[model samples]
Target: MSSTRKKSSRGREGSKNRRWSDRVTKQSNALDLESKIFKSTNPRRIALSLKRSAQASKRRKGTPYQSAMSMLNFYINRAGKSLSQKQKRVLERAKDELRDVFGRK
Candidate 1:
C-alpha cells in the first residue's frame, strides 16, 4: 500500500521531532517571547516573563493571565519528564507566581 502523506519541507534528515506541536512551540505567532523564556530557574522570573509576553502580544484574544498560563502549561506539558525535578518545581511554582502577579485566585 502507498502512503498519501507528503514529505515535510522542514528540518534536515534524521530529525527526531516530527510532531506538529514542536513547530507550534517554535513558530507560534501568539506572543512577544524572549529566547529561552522557559529556561529560567526563577519561578517569579519565568512567570513575569510570560506575563510580559502575554501582555505585549497583540495577537492573543484571551486575558494576559490566561495567555501566560496557557503558554506555561504548554511548556510544562511539552517538556514533561525531560525536565529535571528542580526545573519542574520551578515551573510549577512559576504558575503560582503567575497567578499572584496577575491577581488571579
Candidate 2:
C-alpha cells in the first residue's frame, strides 16, 4: 500500500512538471502585439493603433484589412474571459470602427 501511494505521488509530480514545461514553451512561442490594446480605454484609438501595427507587419497573412481584423479578433477572444461587459462592448465597437477606417464593408 505504501509503495502504491509513493507511485501515485510521483505520477502527480511528473504531471505537474510537464505542465510547467509546457507553459514555459508556450510563453516563449507567444506573439507580442504592438497595439497594447488593454492599456487604452478609447475604442477608436485602439482600432487605429492595431490597424497601423497590422499594416506594418510584413509577416501578416492575407490582405491588410484581413490582417488587421484578425489581430483585433485575436486580442478580443484572448481577453474575453477576463474583460468586463463594458470592455467587451468597447472592443466590439472598435471592430466596427476599424472596418470603417479601412474602407471595408
Global local distance difference test of model 1: 0.83
Using TM-score as the measure, which candidate wins?
A: 1
Tens-place lDDT digits, model 1, residues 15-105: 6665655666667789777788777899999888888989989999898888889888987897453888898999999999999999988
Could you report the Cα RMSD, in angstroms, for every candidate shown? 5.5, 5.7
Say which candidate scores most in lDDT.
1
Candidate 2 per-residue C-alpha lDDT over 1-105 given as tens digits, one digit per residue, 9 for 90 to 100:
455533455666676665543343233223235434645678888778767766776775677678777666765676345678888888888889899889876
Instruction: Give, for candidate 1, the lowest lDDT window spanning 10 residues.
Output: 13-22
Error of 1 at 9 (Å): 19
Error of 2 at 83 (Å): 0.7
Compared with the true structure, all predictions reach lDDT values of 0.83, 0.66
